[model samples]
Target: MASGFSLKDQLFNREKTRYLAGLFAASHAGFDPDRFEAEVMAELPALELKQRISLIAEVLSRHLPQDPEGMAAAILNALPPPLDPSLSDDDFGDFIFAPLGELVELRALETAPDLSLDVLAEITKRFSMEWAIRPYLVHWTDKTLARMEVWAEDENYHLRRLVSEGTRPRLPWGQAVPLALSQPLPLLDRLSGDPTRYVTRSVANHLNDISKKDPELVLTRLRQWQAEGVQSQSELDWITTHALRGLVKQGHSGAMEMLGYDPAAPVTAHLQLGPGPVRIGGALEFDCMLQGPSDAPVLVDYRLHFQRPGGKLSAKVFKLKQTRLKGGTARLSKRHPLKAGASTFTLVPGLHRLDLLVNGIERGSLTFDLLAQAE
Candidate 1:
């Protein structure tokens, strides 16, 4: 087993990596375990996360049953069983459970030619096949929508969540379904009032995705949801806060106002990045001071413009803290991590800029250099 966080590395864990070939060989006829094992592991260390997932799908295509429906059913048969309804309480939450879901994703796509919602319906019950459903959305738009309409009413929370998550216009790392991007509301309308937290969270995320492209639609819908008073205020607030996350970060006045911030107010912001040229693994200590004229609410967050691989800079927001300030003064400090461990980000030796943003307005900036780790 390899120890790492990247999808490529995560896939090759304690048991699944070594035995995926064996599982295929044992389940299907004509797949030589030795050959498949050698092929998969040989290509593994060279590929990144998404590529590795594609490799798994391709390997399955080469070895699985020739008939599409048969291949889909065989993949489902290969899955251990219906997951315990309570994922958090059972081993179902463990990483060991992921490989089955990964297989279901491939099975969803591999069996797409047949367009059997029944197979996907069954497969998703055990493992999510959201990525697999994208192809059908592209090739058989109407049919895919018909099936999704049915999945929306599904008893399983996972399937209902998938009804929103799978159709996200810009699902992060998942396939982009353009139709949903153009007309996000209709699908959202179906899942909007869902009672389950899991389903509602996905619905919030889907609206967040749309907020990136079409902010008004999301704002209008959120406002409508609040006006209609269908769901409790707390649930609606969660959706509003999450869905408008990007907008809030960008300091969109409308979004800020909706979230109960007065962007028009004034505040003095003091930011400091100290002890320049820190080692890669050390922490970057920061201090901030906020002084407001009147009793006004403000949302505070920070952005770090990182040095990218190509020498270009990309900014990422890190949540610092949220608080309500009295008329006078407030002080906040954070010791942010410089070193990377299992996170997606890799620590690179370069110069970076940090910004203090209050109510989405950049107030202060500092330049700092990160040195390579000490030997």
Candidate 2:
């Protein structure tokens, strides 16, 4: 599987290179003997993932039929099938995505919109061309969006997923579409009732993305969906929970109430942090002692207010646990590992505060000293 961070390793490895060579050979045999492989191999180790894709596109530009449409047609020829073999087969990840997706991205924007749409409609079914499709949506918004509405009705789940995923206003790792950001309700209306888990998940995530901008609108729609009962109950539940995850975490009252969390539920909490002055990269153990209304469900989370090197503090919340306290009190102990390896933050030495959030309400807090990291 391709790791999220490094597609270069997963896509451009020796075996993948040979596979690409083989696929090109199988499709267009007269291209080259050693020359094509030489060009690709030379660039493989030298470039990152984005650079590699661009380089491959450039290489294809030199070799494929001269005209852009002809080139697109030739590249489109390389695709195996829309939904012939499931993506679970090993070849789907880099084998299809690295080579084919790049071709769609590099050429589709420049080619005729219809031709590009034709290729994208097929390419997306195999591996998403969501990133490539953005340019079209931005420049040719109406036509592309009309087509997307039709795609929302496609029989294939992949196509349905693309309808929501591609049109997301704030798609992570994807280019932002300003139009989609402003007016996603129409697409959501079309895609929201989709029953497929894969499609519904994308729709939920798309709504979640919109939620960040207009939390109230998304909440209203989610509440409406819950009331309508038009979609699959289980899928809707999943969508509602995930779509409201961000708002729920922030302790929005409407969001909390939608999830049946009663803010007025009486609860008392005490937080304890152990063994002051722990070193960076060491573990910090803490306990949350709580007494709450009997048999009530609780969602427990903690926030770490980390001090920056410049002395400003930035806080991030992490879920601790969720359980039903069937009785008088419960004490939960947790270990937080403080390591500075490949994470967003480097564990800096400063005064750090940890807080307990019960049902999205910050109830208790304590501070601890993190000693300067060892040289």
TM-scores of the models, in the given order?
0.77, 0.89
lDDT tens per residue, model 2, 165-237: 8888788767767574546577777677876667777877887887788888888888777787778777787
Please give the distance, in angstroms, between residue 212's alpha carbon in candidate 2 and its true position after superposition: 1.6
Give candidate 1 regions above 4 Å deviation. Answer: 1-14, 17-65, 72-79, 86-115, 180-182, 272-281, 293-295, 305-314, 340-354, 365-375
Q: Which ten residues in a row have the lowest lDDT in candidate 1?
A: 88-97
Query: Each candidate: what lDDT?
Result: 0.71, 0.74
lDDT of 1 at 323: 71
Q: What value of lDDT does candidate 1 attain over all alpha carbons? A: 0.71
What is the TM-score of candidate 2?
A: 0.89
What value of lDDT does candidate 2 attain over all alpha carbons?
0.74
